[model samples]
Target: MIVITAPTGNIGRHLLPLLLESAPAHGEELRVVVRDPARLPDAVRARVEVVTGSHGDAGVVDRAFEGADAVFWLVPPDATLAPDDAYLGFTRPAAKALAVHGVGHVVAVSALGRGTPVADRAGLVTASLAMDDLLAGTGAAYRALASPSFFENLLEEADSIRENGVFTDVVDGDRRAPLVAVADLAAVAAGLLLDRSWTGTDSVPVLGPQDLSPHDLARIMTEQFGRPVHYARQPLDELYTTLVGHGLHEAFVQGIVDMKRAKDEGLDAGATRTPDTATPTTFAQWCARTLKPAVLS
Candidate 1:
């Protein structure tokens, strides 16, 4: 059996459907650890064994990891806590459970810049890398999907794009870096979960087809929406202030600030885009399929 956590999230939503269609053919029984079973599609709820609770809960993970061969581990972001508490603390229980249950393979969602100098100081990314280490200590064959920003992140700015024909980021408009689609990340996770021949702890960089700058994204959005969309660079200080003003934990907000700073310093630029690392979806395609509809709607 393969256990999938956060099966209703952006990456998990896509991953669940792919596994649902394919796992049966491989003689794999599927299980999901979700907070609300009702959030799952009716058809999906009927197909998989559901362990209802927060995957971060020790009891929940103990129950879910039992009899599991592989696990797709995606930690949901918690802005109310500090970076280490949100990432590493959340995974500690599951790490123990994985060893106890002897779950051999694990595919986790993580950020880029593992070996880069910025990684150690990148706040949330640093916390996430530490979580990966904790899981690796369990002796599971772990693969952390080292990804850059997602094209879907732009969906959060749909209203701004629609109203002002602009999107915002903390990076310079000309700074190019790899960006991925959540679907691509999901597909990569599904592949690892299905084929467990690989062993040892390592990371797979899910870099998109090419590196794109904010200006390139603006150009693509303009083309896709037939509007004069533009890129607006937000000051890092302003971003931190705005997030903290929204009542997020001060340390958590600082983590966001630090992560943005690291990315600006080329934290995500360490990976080379080989065929193994490069995923198929382009920014333009993502805008057409995902962004355009959100902005237009």
Candidate 2:
């Protein structure tokens, strides 16, 4: 059995199909752990066994862990609490469950620069690094696929982009950071889970196709959407002030600002390490293929 958590998320939804397709040749079943089974799409509910429960539910984890060959562990983002607290809080529960079940192979989704000192003050990366540590100690063969900023993140600002003709960010207009598509990330996670060749805490950093700046993004959007899409850098102090005014917690906004500092310094530029020979989808391909339909909607 292969168990997946948050099977309804943007990444998970794409991953589950690939996972089900890649199931072991011996009639292995795919299981999805969801908070509300009824809310899951009809097709998935029918095809996969649905284990309805929270990530904190030990009984649920223990039950799902049984007979499971490999697990896709995802910590869903919680907007209600501090991001760090929400992520770290799930580590103990997950670790205890994996240990008890003696599950061998595992794949975890984590952020890039998770183990580095520069990203420590970036908040979520620090917490994710700690979570990866906790999982690694459970004696399960693990691969934490650490990724940089998500391309889907731009979707959240779709309304702003459509209305104002620009994308907003704290990083300078020319600052280039790795931007990955969730589809690619999910595909990589599924591939790692099926291969099961790697073990013992290997950090797979997926740098996407390139380190894109806002200016580059705008050019791509313009060509794809037939409109002038520009990059607007939000001043640090003003961005901080605006987020607070919009009810975002100060610490959380600080975390965002801190992350941009790393981007400005080009820590994410190291994505070129993924070997030039490897296959990667370019930003232009992403805009027309993924971002265009999403933006129009």
lDDT of 1 by residue, 98-139 (tens): 999999999999989999989998988999999889988999
Worst 10 residues of 1 by lDDT: 284-293
- Score candidate 2 by TM-score against the native: 0.91
Model 2 over residues 1-297: C-alpha lDDT tens digits? 788998888889889888777675646688889998987778768789888898767788888888888899998866455656667776678789899889998898887774355766766666777788888999999888778888788887788878888888878888777888888888888888777777687788877877778898898899889988888888888877887788877776666667667667665655445572123767788778877887787
| Candidate 2 residue-wise lDDT at 92 | 78
- Top lDDT model: 1
Query: Residue 51 lDDT in model 1?
Result: 99
RMSD of 2: 2.2
Candidate 2 residue 5 Cα shift, in angstroms, is 0.4
